[model samples]
Each structure stands twice: as C-alpha cells, then as structure tokens.
Target: MDSLQPILNSIQKFQQQHSQILREASRVAMISNYIPDEAFRMAKATENLTRQLKIINSDSIQKAFDTISSIKLDLHLPSFPKFDYLEFDEQRLERITRHNVSVGWTLTGDMPINLYLRDEYLDMEHDEIDKIFIAFYEEDEYVQLKTLIKNVKNGLSEKWSEILDQSLDLYLEGRYKITIPALISVIEGELSSIIGSSKYGKRLVDEFHNKLDDKMKFLTIAAYSAYFFFDEHLFKSHDFTHARLPLLNRNWILHGRDDPSAWKKEDALRLLNTLSTLQFIKEIEIAEN
Candidate 1:
C-alpha cells in the first residue's frame, strides 16, 4: 500500500486535470450563449435609434411645421360655406337675436345676422341690429336685394320671381301696400313649398319645423315669431293688426288689416332676409333627403 501511494497520487492528479477541463468547457459554452444574446440586444437598440433619427432627421421640416402651427389662416373666407361663415352656434345666435328684442325688433332665427361682426355686433345696443341688418340693403342701394332675389330664385320668372320683381318695383316707388302683400304672398308660397302643404298658418309652422334638426330649427326660430317663440309680434291676428316697429304681422299684412305705414323699405329688407333663410331651409331639405 505504501509503494502504491505515488500511483494513487498520480491518479488523483489526473482526475483533478480532467475536472478542470470540464469546468473550462462549461464556462466557454455559457460565454458563447451570452455573446449572441448581448449582440442581438445591441442590434435591436441600433435599429430603434435609426428609426427615431429617420422621423426627425430634417430640422428644417420640423421648424416649418412649427411655424405653420403658429399662424392663423382666415383671409379670403368671408363668403365661406354656411357652417364655416356661421361663427356662432344656434344658442349663441338665439342670444344675439334676443338682444334686439330690447329695441322692439323681435329678431327671429330666420334673419341672417352678419356673423362676421362677432363681438362688435353682439356687444351693440339701441337699434344697432336694424342699423347693421336692414340698413345694409339701403346702404348697398338694393344691390343686396338684387343678389338675394337671384339666390332665392335660381332663374328669372320662376317660383315668385316675377312677383318678386313687381314687389321690388313697387317698393322702389314707395308703394309698400302693393309690395308688402305681394311679398307676403311669396313668403307664404315659399313656406307652403317647404312644408309640401297648401298653406302655412298657425300649426303649419310647427309642421314645417318638424322636418328640421335642432340646429336647422334655429333658422325657424330666427324667422317669424311663430316658430320657437310664438307670439303677437310677427303673426298678430288679422283683427288685432294695429301695429308698431317689430309688430310686422303676417296675418295683418296679408289680410289688409295691418297699418300701411308698417310696410317700409326696412320691412321689405326683413322679408328678404326671411327669404334667404327659407333658402337655407330648402338647402337643408335637399341635403337631408
């Protein structure tokens, strides 16, 4: 056994060497696995960085976008579409119209208020609505009316065009009695055309308004007194036609009971504004259908 000690020591040394070789191999295998994973992670990070750089590589492009965002672009937009030209919502428009009621001018939603006036118009008082609304026609020397007639009637001598011409001529000559009734006939005819009914009186307004959405109905509310706020202002009974400034009654005007003095250029302007509003209704009807 003493003689075999050297041999045993040699065997033990060989075992230790083999174990060290196995440990080295295991470590190399682990390092090989770690190197691939670390390289893949680095490749992914580089790809993401490249993508980010591509998106914002041009400082000038980014700066141009920033500059455009800072600017306002509203020029040449005066005759913009109805929705675009209308700066206020239905509620704001109603509030604006109601502002005129203080001056004995019962402004309904039918009247096309100058929306571009914005704060200047809304902040006004003391017959300002009339000065801005009705006077524009007089100031423009009925050129506005001529344009409006063209708009409401696509072609001459069609759908109240002849009568409209007659009314305008009578109005020009100060024959308001002739003009007002003729204009009233056109208005009633326009309303009848919209409602697809023979007549538009009393409950017919409600029926006419039924075809409109809340926003579109704002136009009706803006029209005569009979729409949203039915009252004696615009549609006073024929028997009670004794009148004032805003009391331009449809029944009174139509039945020959209204004051002849009530029909003036201003009244003609208002009815024309109403015709424009009805044109809006016609547009809405076409769009919805």
Candidate 2:
C-alpha cells in the first residue's frame, strides 16, 4: 500500500551489487574462526560502500522508514508490556542445569550453539529419560534436538513479531529511545512465558535468556538480534567477533556512533559477521539436534 515499489527499487539497486553483497554476506556468515581472511577484507570494502551511500543520501533515513514499512514481514510480534521491567519474572531460572552435558558449557551462554547443544542433550535425555549420557549422545540424534528447538523457536517467533511491531510503532511515532526499554521488557516477558510453558521450550529458552541477561541484562540488546541486519555504511574499520557481517554491519553502521568508539565499518562488520555466523551455527546445531 505504501508503494513498496520505491523501497523495493532501492533494495534492487543494492541487489544489483549482489556479487559484493553476497561476498560480504558470506564473510558475515563465517566471520568467526571458521571463515578465511580475504573475505573479511572484502566485507570491509563493501561496508564502506554502504556508509558512503548512506552519507550521500542522508535522505536514506526516509527511504529506510519507507522500505521497512513496505516489506511484508512474516514475523509475529508480541504485545506491549503490561507493566515495567521490574514486573518481569526475573526470579525464575532455566530448568536445564549446566552439568547435564559434556561440553562443560551451560544451556546459558553467549554463543547460541552452546544453548543449541544443551537443548539437544536435554531432548535426548527427555526422550530416553533413563539412558546414560554415553549411549544417547551421537551425531544422528541432532535431528530430534532440532525439532524441539524449532517448536520453541516457532513460539518465540510469534513473540519476536510482536516485539518488532511495538518497537517499530514507537520508532515511527518518535518515541523509540524513550519507550524502547518497555518494549524490550515485553519481549523478555514473552520469551520467559514461552520458555516456562513447556519443559523443552523452558530449558532452551531459559538457557538462552539467562546467558543474554547475564551478559547484557537488557532485553533491547538481545531483541535487536532478532531483526537487525548489516549496514555497511558506517565506520572505516573494527575488530572481529562470531556474527553475521551484514547484520553486524547494519547494527554498528546504524548505532555505532551511539558507542564511543565511532567504530570502523570495516572492523565492526567483520566482527559482527563472525558473531552472526556463530548465531547461525548455533541455530543449525539446534536445528540438527
């Protein structure tokens, strides 16, 4: 209805440079220890291109709003918080213990793979109920684990959509900064409720949320991961992490200035890509389980 054509056209313009975008995306996918080095450099270059374009078309602000509104997102958003962050069920902890698996990792860790593995192990234990760890742990069992994760993820996806819708509304209404925390609280509550609803879902979701809360403790930071994409237009360089480069680039490019670093697009995107890829790896590991 908003003539998605303009937004689509802009994305198409960028898509024309698909080769570069894909390269950046690839680098982003494996920006972690798993990927090579040459691609990292290329990602930086592409990121610069995005930054320059953003600067040239300061009007990109409008285009961004228009494009975002035009897209037919499949995500299901959650509702606004009934109360404040103080109202969330912070007392509750994940049902899964860290000792259940051999990885010496908890279900709650920054790397989603860790949670994915933990979830897989939990599902295995759940199905067998009495089998010793040695007998149940195997490469093939990953399929069942993934199925369980998918169930929880599907439920959470509905929540993600809600979070996005609320955040977008606040953003469009010019209340983003002021109201974002409330939206984040809603997101946390939704995830908490979903996790607590099912044994398997609770195990996986709690593990993930606990880890996130430990590190950042803010729902807004974690929620941003669900929808944020890479924006290569900011910064000249940054360090590395295990994330998707495009998404990282977009995050830093869009918000890096809010950080004191004035972060380099090249470095930030590389690191962000690594982190994103790691997230994907975690998803894959969970899916496989």
Candidate 3:
C-alpha cells in the first residue's frame, strides 16, 4: 500500500496542474475569438490551441483517476482469521456478557456500589474486547499490539474525519481521484482490528454487499465498514427508533440518491458508529442479561 501513497499524491499533483491548464486554455479560447487572424495562425497556433483544450478535455484523465480510486484495498489485520469468537463456549459468552452488563450498570450509578461483580465482569470482558481492539496474535508475535492499536485508532480516525468532512468538494469537482481512495484507506486502517475480526467478517461482508457501487466503490467500502461497526443495535434502546439509526433514510429516502458511493464521510462514520455500538451490545447481551 505504500506504493499507493505515491500514486495518490501524483494524482493530486496532476489534478492541480491540469486545472491550471484548463483555466488558461479557457482564457486563450476567449482571446482567440476576438484576436485578429494573425495571432491565431502564428505558431501552429491552431494546433496548439486545439491541443491544449484536447488535453484538458481528455476523458482518460478522469477515467484513470476513477480506476485507481476504485481499486479495492482491503485493510485486514494480519492475524485476523486465527481469532475465532465462536470457538468460545456459551458459558464463556455468558461470563463476558455479565461483565459488560455490570459495567454498564456501574457506569450509570452515582455513588460507589458493590462493584466487585461489575469489576469482575469488566475485567474478563475487557480481555475479549481488548483482543478485538488490538490484534489477537501470539504474545510473541506482537509485543506492543495494544499500544499499536491505540495509536493507530487515534490517527486513522482523525484522517477519515477529514475525508468525510470534505466529501462534497471532492465528488462535485470531479476530483474523485484525490478523495475516494483516501477515505477508504483511512477508515479501513482505523477499524482493522474489529473490521477484520473473524467473528464479524461475515457481517461486514454482508453489509458490503448491500452498499457496493462502482462510481464510488472506495466510499462504498468505507461506508459498509461504518455500518459494520456502528449501526443502531449496539446501543441501549427499548426498540428501533428512526433517530437512532445511522444515516437512516439519508440516501435512498432523504436525498433519493440510492448510490452508496455518493455518501458523505460523516454519514459513513455515523453508520459505522451505530452498527459497531449495536454489535457490541448484542454480543454482550446473553439470554440472562
């Protein structure tokens, strides 16, 4: 993926360079119309004039950008497939759920209560969640996976924050080359631990199927990730509420834009937050809790 950074940077540079060319050509076109026949024929001036505009109008530039940006880059954690949640027994899940429930209760209380139950639960559940947040590789395989996850999550989240915030500028201006892939890389890199988890891979893939699109495949991939981790079910709620859902009706209903690739970054992040939070709650809620 390091190779991709340079290519992306080049795309940005090319866009800026060509934009200047386009502006100059437009000015030349205006001047040529009024200038006498002499300047128009001076330096193969007809050819030069047409050539500049042709370069500016070439569809290949935009198509090239679209192709590179659309190329899917799966940012899976290296050891994800080995960590299987289903391997744990029902009793283990119950234990983890009890821990999560106790923590939820304790977090809500004002004064200190007998949090021994809560602490016990949180400690055990924390181990599992930590494994999901960080990589669950052999201890020797990753001496500082915990620290790595923390740093990466912060950096990656901030990176995607910028992309989502500027989605409109990139798309509307035909600058997909500079924006789409960047958003994908940031989101995938940030959420790799949970996104790549074997426990949730099927779910992630399922969501991707629903959101996939060609024009904005990079954004679509990112959006699916948002929904994968942060959808509505993760939070505590009596039932599904319209306001509770991430990006609820924003595309197909709100804007009538069914194209998933066109979704803004914040919308994608909101979806991810909703899905992930709901998933966390559902995974913790046992038959008893």
Ranking by TM-score: 1, 2, 3
**What TM-score goes with each of the models?**
0.55, 0.22, 0.19
Candidates by lDDT, descending order: 1, 3, 2
lDDT scores in order: 0.47, 0.32, 0.32
Candidate 1, TM-score vs. the true structure?
0.55
Residue lDDT tens for model 1, 187-263: 66777786688646655566655644444422433343224322334543445533343546777666656678655
- Give the per-residue lDDT of model 3 (tens digit) for 51-96: 2221112342334334434434353212212212243233543443
Global Cα lDDT for candidate 1: 0.47
Candidate 2 structure, TM-score to reference:
0.22
Winner on lDDT between 1 and 2 is 1
In angstroms, how far off is 253's CA in candidate 2? 27
Clashes of each: 6, 37, 16
**Number of the top candidate by TM-score?**
1
- Tell me model 2's lDDT, rounded to 2 decimals: 0.32
